[model samples]
Target: MQQSADILKLFEESAIAAGRVILDIYRAGAAVRLKGDTSPVTEADEAAERLILAALARHMPDVPVVAEEEVAAGRIPDVSGGRFILVDPLDGTREFIGGHDDFTVNIALIEAGTPVLGVVHAPALHTLYLGGAGKAEKVKLDDKDAVIARMPIAARLKGASPSALVSRSHNCDATDAYIRKAAILERKTVGSSLKFCMVAEGVADLYPRFSPTMEWDTAAGDAVLRAAGGMVATEDGAPLTYGKRLPGLRAFENPPFLATGRPSERG
Candidate 1:
């Protein structure tokens, strides 16, 4: 229990530190570059990843790390032990570049292919979500990254008409069709893993993603949601697992999944 608590603390601190680096770059105006996958990356992402990787190495050198920018640069580490760190230094790069406040910094610890500890920090929004040590909480942070208040969070019970959240950048016809079939009462679009955090906090009831995503992209938020009495699962109703590899991909990727604040409504 103590060890899990320590790791959770490490994740929260590292996420906040990375958020600082990201916010600095965001303020100074970041330079954008495109990855081979045609995805946009910025100096903020690289610098934040460096800071987060260094912090994780200093605090937990034995644990392997699989970070987005590092993996994109071909720094795939051995994660055969089912325990490793996942970092998405700057999630929602497009939103960040567009001066939107929805981007976030994600850090998670996956053990036995399940996220056991995680932290998601939105620097511009001054919000942080943390899960581990048998609890989940949403924190309000100040401009200097100091925690102002924190309160336990949990997913709401399924209602007559549950709200649904979708990706702001990748909302396609398939996602729309799924939401329509679910007969959701309302819909909200958000960037980054905030969609998961919203469900974790009971602000939204469901988030279904039909598009491709990486493990690091969702693990932290997944941890938070699960800790908050929610769940993320594949379309087949199996829990989402990390450390996945596709046939031709060296990096970890996620299959299509659904995140729900009300587990009973998952069906």
Candidate 2:
């Protein structure tokens, strides 16, 4: 097994490289195309995925990679060993296309069905989150994608009237209803895996997603959150596991999950 520091560094470098590619496309106003599922894809997504996949192949050839654009193009690899890397080269594609700054590049290492290391970089926002080796931290990035400053981060224990983070683009009535039922003190709508990072950094208390999400969408942020003393669980209160596959179907799909900074409270 690779040392946690090595894995974390690899993930950070891959995410930053991918983030640079994404920002270049964002500035150029990338053209969007629809996939078979009707989800929007952009040049930024493909370019970033290629960059990340190449970096991983060079540094960690023994590990498999399950990347978004590749899988969408029918490049599925065998993940039966439950160890691999997950990449969402450009998560929140809709947000990116809409010119929102919440999109991110996510890279994660999954071992035996658990996310062991992760790095999430928001190029437009100039923010990055890293988690692994029993620690998590948030960093400020420069325009050139260099780290300016960083501070360790952890989830805050929930108090009375906790806040919640929800998807700004994919918001549904079911989520709103859940927030109401939880007696949430506040609700903030943001895009991409940043929701998970928010809880990890104590910016928010809870993030519940009742809508559809793939594992790549959540794994990296889930790793960061878990490393920061948070938890991501299914509706049945089970921790979300990776390397999931259906018989003769798509692999690494995810079920509805709830992420919380404070497992003790329901908000």
Candidate 3:
């Protein structure tokens, strides 16, 4: 971790670059493939990963990157010590394939099993959410950088719904049950990591996904949510703590989790 300013600026640049790659492939309609996990993959993922990885290497050379495409290509980086960046170049392949504008570019800095900074950029939406330095703010960037909404955690506007923003394409049975039991007021379906960003920006209240998810899938959003006074927790109400080293494990995966808008909102 460097200065919060430098890291965040680097993250914003990389995220927007990845966003450009995503939008290009998205509009051009690229080829699609499947990974070993049976998840969708596309050239956009690879291109975005390349762009993000290159930026990270040039700017934060010391920080290793755990990228989704690289991991799927059997090239997971070594993150056994210190700090690293976790990236998901194309987070919602389903939404991307369906010709919807819900996918995003995700990037995060993790130190000692905790994410210290995160950025989520939805190029199609022209929205960027950044959280770090004990603060979180949502920025809407255009040809010129402009701050659309900037507020510390406590100053965000509260929504009218007991809002539950869930994955647009990957809904599980457990999520249905959670939503019903929670008595949600409004439901918004968006793809990719933007679900988490919705909560971070106060557009929604909670996101509960009781389905299996890899660490990279949630690390960036997790950091943003946490920095914005929210948390990703387990069923038992434990805040997600990443990067646990096991004796022989090469890397790690996350269990089913719940993402909430506020600590007190957890029930």
TM-score of each: 0.96, 0.96, 0.90
Candidate 2, pairs of clashing residues:
none
Candidate 3 lDDT, 1-267, residue by residue in tens: 469879988898888877877787888898988789888899999989998898888888887888888888888677888587888888888988999888888898888888889988888888888888878878777644455665454313344557788787888888989888877768888788888877887778878887667777888888888888888887777777666543543466776677777666665
Q: Write the per-residue lDDT of candidate 2 for residues 27-111, one digit (tens) a residue.
A: 9899999999999999999999999889898989999999998999999888888788999999999999999999999999898
Q: Total clashing residue pairs per candidate?
A: 0, 0, 0
What TM-score should be assigned to candidate 2?
0.96
User: Given candidate 1, what's the lDDT at residue 155?
Assistant: 90
Q: Write the per-residue lDDT of candidate 1 for residues 142-199, one digit (tens) a residue.
A: 8888889999999998788788899888788888898888777699889999999999
Error of 1 at 193 (Å): 0.4
Q: After superposition, how far is residue 126 of candidate 1 from its true place, in Å?
A: 0.9
TM-score: model 3 vs. ground truth: 0.90
Q: Who is ahead in TM-score, 2 or 3?
A: 2
C-alpha positional error of residue 85 in candidate 2 after TM-score superposition, expressed in Å: 0.6
